[model samples]
Structures are given as structure tokens and as C-alpha cells.
Target: MSTAAEIADHKSSVRERVWTELRKVAVADSRFHFDFGEFIADFEGGEEAVHRLIDHSFYRDAELIFITPDNCLDRLRLRALQDGKVVLMTTYSIKRGFWLLDPAKIAPDHYLYASTLDGMERVGQHLTLAEIQATLPNVDYMVTGTGAINHEGVRFGKGHGFFDSEWGMLYQIGRISVATPCAAVVHDCQVLVEKLTPDVYDTVVDIIFTPTRTIEVHNPHKPTCGIIWDRLDQHMFDTIPPLQELKAMGL
Candidate 1:
């Protein structure tokens, strides 16, 4: 096994390499298939499979759903609409991290909805854009609990830091308190044992959901080091206007 510092260095390099691969693959796939959607639909029950993945967390009782940024599978979350089982899922927000997409339009008055940073809004029990905007640092709605979480060690899309940036901003602003449970769903093929060098700003998830099973992490939160004002990157701070305002207010 490599030392902690060495593992971090290796993992950082792996992250970069993986991002390059995903970009190239995504681009090539897009070019050859102008109607990739139609092509995917041709597969026996491919559409249904997509729906299954998106609704997985909801079926597991996830109140908040966090979807990936890839446009290819955007419509998968619409299948979870069962009356009384409303769930909210986040999409790319014009401002930052993610915004909730309506869980009902696809199913009718079947689900509830909410919004986030950007102009991103959706159907179902809508939380006024203003309310999400006013989320305070110490609010209970923003808090999460600590526990063993898993990422399955799968790298996200090209690792542009959007996910990390969004989580970090929420954490800094006190939106997602220290206790909120977070996890990533992935195929078992995505798990990695490599060392991860998490910076002070990195927000780790509490669990990893695989197609077959769920892996629990024991302790998820990291120790707090001093804040690095200069270290705040564009992706992290720019998406959150409130974060900027808070900083100006003396962050």
C-alpha cells in the first residue's frame, strides 16, 4: 500500500486520466449517433432500465435525489411517480451544484417538487425559489448526519469538480449541515481501492449504492482545517451568489 500522501498523488493523477477518457468517449458517442435517444430506445427495455436507476434511491426512501450531469439519461427520474411517494431530484442549476426537477409532470399530481441555486425549478410541492435562496447556514433543513458512506470509488463525469464544488458551497453556507446523508449510485465495476487525496474543501459522501448492494461507510466527515479564502475556486464560489454575498458579509 502507498503512503497517504503518495496515494493521494496517485489518485489525483488517475482522476485526470479518467476525465480525459470520459470526455473522448462521450464526444465520440455523440458524433456517431445524432439520435442516440432513439437508438437507446430500440434496446429491449433500455428506457425502463434507465428509469430503474433513477428511481433506485427513491425506492430506497431517498427524500432528495441527486442526478448526474450527463444529458443522455436525463429523463430517467420521471418513472418514480407514485402517489404519496414524492421525491425530489437535483439537476444542473444556472447558479451552482444542482436544482430540483419536478417529479410529477411525468406522472401527474403524483409527486412533489423543489428548486435550488439557479433559476432551476420543477413541479410538485414547489419550494419557492425565494425560500431556497434564503437558506441560512444553521438551518435544520440544511443539516445532515454523519455515518459510514460510500462513493464506490467511482469517478464522476470528467471530474470538472461541479459535484464537489456544489457540495462545498452548501457546506460553507450551512445549507447541507454536517449530518445530511449523501451517496453515489454506481455499478460494481466503478469501485476503486486507490487512495483519494481529499482537499480541505472536498465533501465526501456517506454511502455508495451499487446495483446489487449498498456499502456503508463508518465515519464520513473530515476534520476541519483553517478556511482557505484564496483557495476557493471559480466553479465552487461562482455558482452560488449567496455564497458570494455571505463572503462579502464576512465569511
Candidate 2:
């Protein structure tokens, strides 16, 4: 069995390898440099992948979705709004908490602009954890962009725990459950054949959608514990307001 340190080291090596490959073929993001801080690169055929996700029954059936603010997911967010699906998205690192984007409230002309991070703040309603618990419906599906993922469903992103924290917080608040399916959208090169181990708090996705195909993991491991408070550091508590809010609320 690999120790935690060994697994982390392996994951790091995998990320370096994948990121290098991604830059070689990634579509340029005008707002960010490809090598920018933990940016999930938009890959070749990425728009096609989003279209594939839109066609999936999980996405088609979902009335509400919790999507991360990864660069690769901008199109998905836009499509969700155009389809009249409610979108719950967090700010960069969840520093500013969550934003709820209701299609009905947005002007049809702004759907394209509303999908971008800057546009979301202008058009989407911001929500606190308490507000989310009191108002929003349970999330029907979850989608995120990943740095690297394997056939077994294990994934990590640019060494940041943002997605894990998002998942943990939502799970704690009863917005999502073990039965709620999650999907990871990535470039084909980001999918690994080598086995990757997951930490206790790491999220395992039920499905992996690449530009070329969708691969489902049989009986994927999903974390039941919401937030592992003890593992969090003072930096996280200081940087992310939602964490502080949750802590103060004794959640």
C-alpha cells in the first residue's frame, strides 16, 4: 500500500506531465495565460466535450447543478443558463462564497456574457451558506474541471483543494448526497491509465467526460464525511470567508 506522502508525490509527478502535454494542444484563453496559477486549460475539442455533456442524460435531466468556476466549464455554465437550469457556482476559491444564477432572472441577450466569471458576479445573485440552506433546492448533478483523472475515477486539480472544500461544504449542508452523481470534464490526455490513490477527503467522480468519450466508473468511491476540519489550516480559514462563516456557525 502507498503511504499518503507517496501518493501525493505520485500525483505531483502526474500533474507536471499532464500540464506540459495540455499546453501543447490547449486552446488559448484570452483572459489568462495557459501557464497561469492552477488554471484548468481549455483543450482542443473542449467545446465538443461540453456539447457531449449537454447530451448526457444526467445533464439533460438536471434542473439545478453545482459547477465549479474552472475555465474549462464556462461553456457548460452558459448552456445550463440557456437551458433554463439553475446554476450554483462558487467564486474563485470560494473566497466570496456562492452565486446562484437563475435563468429566468437573466436577460436572454446576456446568456453569453453571464457565463464568464466577471459576468456571473454582475448577473447572478450571491448567497451565503445559511441562505443556500434556506433557499436552494438540492443539487441534481455536479460537474467540475480536473487537472488529472484516472479510469478508476480518482482526480485532483492543480494541487488546490478548492473543489474538495466545495464538495465538503455542500455535503455538510445536505445539498448533495452519496447518490448524487458527479462528473469530471477533462482533455483526453488528462485521463490516466495508471492507478492514482485518493486521500480520505478527496472526491471520486462517477463519470469522466473527455473530448472523445464518456467513461463511467463502476461503484466509484464517494466521500461521506463532509469537511475534515482538523486537516484544514489557518491559511484556508483566513482566506476563504465561507469556511470562517461555517466555523462561526458551528457547522
lDDT of each candidate versus the true structure: 0.41, 0.87
Give the Å shift of residue 142 in candidate 1: 11
> Which segments of model 1 are wrong by more than 4 Å?
1-9, 16-61, 66-76, 79-98, 102-130, 133-157, 222-228, 235-251
RMSD of each: 7.6, 1.3
Worst 10 residues of 2 by lDDT: 29-38
Q: How do the predictions measure up, each by TM-score?
A: 0.55, 0.96
Query: For every model in order, what is the number of clashing pairs?
Result: 15, 0
Which digits, one per residue and each the tens of the lDDT, describe model 1 over residues 1-251? 56867755565566455433333323223333423221111122334434444444434554444443334333333433332223333344324323444444434542322222122343333332234446412322211111111253233323344455445544554455556665544434334555454555555655655445556566765324223557656664666564465466563
lDDT of 2 at 140: 96
Question: Which predicted model would earn the best lDDT?
Answer: 2
